[model samples]
Target chain A: MADRRYTKTHEWVTVDGKTVTVGITDYAQSQLGDVVFLELPSPGRTLGVRESFGVVESVKAASDLYSPVAGKVSAVNEKLSAKPELVNSDPYGDGWIMKLELTGELPPDLLDEAEYKKVTEAGAH
Target chain B: MVDFGGWELPQQYTSIRNEHLAVRKVAGLFDISHMGRLVVEGPGAEASLQWLMTNDLAPLAPGHAMYTLMCKEDGGAIDDLVVYRESKDRFLVVVNAANRAKDTAWMQEHLAGSATIEDHTKDMSLIAFQGPRAHELLPKGSSKTDDIPYFGFRAGKVAGESALISRTGYTGEDGFELFVDSGGVGEVWDAILAAGKAQGVLPAGLGARDATRLEAALRLYGNDMDETVNPYEAGLGWTVKLGKPDFIGRDALAKVKAEGARRSLVGMRTEPGSIPRHGAAVSHDGHHVGTVTSGTHSFFLGHPIALAMVEGPSFRVGERVTIEVRGREAPADVVKLPFYRGSARSAVAPAKP
Candidate 1:
């Protein structure tokens, strides 16, 4: 969890060496209740930092999933197409949206766990 | 929680999907106290209401109810409401909460010689016990809750509280709406919840309510139609009794009837992955046809459904249409009104759809 970085848009990325895993934070999933569907970029798509890579849809709304770091898409979680509710039930683990292999620089504005928690807490009110 | 017409209410108590399924398979309770409850009584009650409303209440004997609309002189909707004939000289008019003030002023301004109007909205608590299992959950004293026919009300004691149990609901299910004193509402609400908890009855909220009503294709006043929309175009032409001698909007409605609607309300269905939100644009073959009036991801029906006011005489059933969802034109099929039906259809009533 300490390795995870978050964007103001509510997406989180965990970088381990050259490969990074991406998903929405638990706070994001709670705000968008009952995820029903997801649209993820397939392997080989190049994404710049902060670019919209896909979409996450819940019963309440549809939000764009932005990339926190510049990278080339390596894989998308196929588990989501069969069960999107994972985004609501286990947003940080099984709900992980995609994995990317780093190709470009990481966004400097990405927040660490403590910083992201502060951002989400401020929005709760 | 959100403020709905000055009443604080949650969009979903548990979850919209779970609460919606409870109403479909078991039961769900809702606090519908926001709806305006007005009592009109006196010798002229029947005649005055008949003149103001589109439905002729002449044959509406006491103990019966009729769904009708009140319109402006231009035939645009004032409000869609249900009038319950309680007795020969008294009637109860339930109207939309947002239109309470407007409806009251309109009714009073057009008041006739004998009848009087009283707003009981602040004095009464309205609870909807809706679902297929609704009848099984009501308090079992006199067992009168089971006897009230659809749209019919019976004054009785429920959970030891004086109540008027009416077999009616906005959900497309067999249900009873209980009207009780506002001060003692919590007692009755708790009693009903305790009784039905074992059967998966949930305290539902606005989210589930909106979804169920959309599946049934019941029009919401402000969303589906308003002061500028007429009955013929809002898919409620059946509630207009043009045969009646005279009403506030009779002349204009007659003209519309003779000429036919240029744009009419129609139902549209999309796949499971996408939802049609309100105010989304509806298009056909790259041309903007109309706009979505009301829409939701129907948790019970398992498909996203919508009601749109499209250019009529052209948008027929089975025609493929498109809705702009998230900046993309999502494909949808134009279907019949009432994306689904339930036990409420079993009761004898005016034609639906």
Candidate 2:
């Protein structure tokens, strides 16, 4: 629970015991503009690391939401149905998309906070 | 970059939603330099336009502009344009960006008189300043909103440079579209930005322009209507004048007018807040009738809106329709066109000399 890692696709995953909470990064949310509709995975869905699990539709286009960790979906963000803007207002906080029960240990390819900054800086250009 | 009429342009500078809200709440400046401006000047200028355009141009006095469509011989639209009667022998036509080359060529080949046709798009830069506070933020000069009425334009000084200013826009808000020399266009843009900064003005991109125009139900050239789409079926029958003596596609249009079109443009709104995308299938009851031409989240309205060209069985307002949004048939209602209208151009007086 004390450490969180990010994916090259901008999804952030926080691992605590066998469960992990996943959501898009603040940088990703800002770039996405306003979040209007979220296609979330079902609670029973299972995903492999780096798999595209859902889509986030904004005012302009729909972007794929990728999973950073291999896990089975435990819960989805239900409030986004009425208030998807929460993703824009607070991406890492209230906008968290799903909770997943880990299928195995957290992936070793995940980037830490400082390493994630380097990836996003490259994307800024 | 998005391909808008062959021009690669940024779809959004910051964010589409932010840019949309910026124009609604404050002011937004758009680079519309890609739009074509053609000048027709000579003794037969009026006659040439009268024969080409569908709208009644004979009634247009000097310094007046009217929106019209130039249809093909088959009654399909060539382009939707605005014709300005600058003088008895002088006229200016503003055409969509994508159709500039085709429209210019079509008009030139059709001219059978002493009129001179000129394509001024390359030499000129078109900038649109739009929003609720546009009037207050526009640079002070002869092109002031108080002087130019809606759809009216005049050659005046803008930002210390000679420019043509028109009280016109597609955003349905109060605004001015200025045409400046291509070289000095950046200067005019910078000047307006500096003047309107305190008023919350933004250098908007195509993202905001699309949203704003869609809110007003203004049609996009390629998306809303194209060469394959007739003006009447596109819900732009108002621009076509059937009694205009003899114009391009007049006979075909007259016949089509008598026989109702099999398909028509209509607005669709979805429930559960699913935003439809372009090319999504549209259905009635359980049968597929049409496909969505343009669909997006109306940031200003806090809901989703779609423009669909559906088959006959003409949908009345409030009738339920389903759209296949993202592989699933989503429920939507066939609402009236123009899901939202702002207070911009709606507040201007009739354009006059």
Candidate 3:
């Protein structure tokens, strides 16, 4: 099982072995209502922690995608372009945004799924 | 709920997609109390309006309403409003919420008669029940007694409260816009909700409103047209009565119509995956033409659509063009206005195919 963490901006990162999958939290998707378009970063791009990786556009507004862990972008979610609603329907599973190859030690502030749930329940997102 | 023009109005009481589909499939109710209503009454009302508006109001009979453009002397659109002729000497001007105070001040400064201008917005709450089932949901005896027809109105009661129901709406649907006293708004809303509950009436909000209006190609005041754009250029040339005896911006509109405005409103449909957005640059053959004013993924139409005001040499229908989405320019085709028509009564009464 992957260990999950979240950012105040509503991004989530799941560390599975050496790869970290990043995506917007379910709370973010609910607030956005519908995800119409997703602009993803290309695979193999190097990114620092908290760096903006892409943009998610809803019918009403556009929001930036941020990286929770610093590393090289190993893979991008190609399915989002044709069906961005997947981000809304499944924000934590198949809707994962990008897979980053962890370059160094994982940060400590990354909350567990239980902690993420607590943060979300507190209505921070 | 979303903050629209500083008003914390619901985006949808339930779900936007569901509410939108309900309006298309059945009916949807909207709490549009945020819209502003101004009353112009007294003997000088006619002359005062004639000088402030572009439509030929002198011809509008009592109980009639006309969608008009309130413009500056330079012909720039101040706001698009619905002027309801309550009588020869009294009128109801419905302005966009964001422009209410500003519009009132502008009209007050241009007053030419003993007509008293009063802002009835805060005192009155506006609600709209729109869809194919609009008439089916409204209280009995609510539909016009006479041939009020589309774009017309009549004073009547809804849910046992004094109301002014008009056959007007932002959605291109068979609808009624009700004006009721603010204090009784909550009760009226509950009554209508209960009355239409069996018919799948949802309390729609700003999200559903935007989608329906966009599908109809109805120009939003702050987005599609503004003080910098004239009515003629915003695909409202029909509303401009050049022969009107006299009105503000009449000369500027005539000149613009004659010489052709710099840009004209046009509709564009992009490839399935790329949806253009507001402020996105519009282009043709690699040259910037205009900008996208409003764009959305029409859930009913199942495609990404947009409305743009492109410069002269507008692309003909079916002619391919390009619109910059994100950073890359994507292929789009120019099309006639109105991307989708609803199941409204007006649309149901087919106009010779």
lDDT of 1 at A114: 91
The best candidate in terms of lDDT: 1
What candidate 3 gets wrong by more than 4 Å, as runs, is A1-3, A15-21, A39-54, A67-83, A93-105, A112-125, B139-148, B344-353
* 1 or 2, greater by DockQ: 1
DockQ (C-alpha based) per candidate is 0.56, 0.55, 0.40
Looking at model 1, residue B104 earns an lDDT score of 96
Count of steric clashes across candidates, in order: 0, 3, 0
10 residues in a row with least lDDT, candidate 1 chain B: B139-148
* Residue range B1-353, candidate 2, lDDT tens digits: 67788777777776677778888888898998888999999988888888899999999877678999999988999999889888899998999988888999999987758998998888988999888888777775535557677788888878888888877888888788888999999989999988988877888888789888887888887887888888888999899899877999998888888898778999988864588888889888799899888888887887888899888837999998889977788889888767887876566655678
Top DockQ hit: 1
List lDDT for all candidates, in order. Answer: 0.88, 0.85, 0.85
Q: B96-196, model 1: which lDDT tens digit per residue? A: 99999999999998878789999999999899989988787775552565456788887888888888888889999998888899998899898888888
Quote model 1's iRMS: 1.3
Candidate 1's displacement at residue B244, Å, is: 1.7
Name the DockQ score for candidate 2. 0.55
- CAPRI quality band, candidate 1: medium
Candidate ordering by DockQ (highest first) = 1, 2, 3
B140-244 per-residue lDDT for model 3 (tens digits): 435442344778788888888888878888888877889999998787888888888898988998888999999989999999999999987898988898898
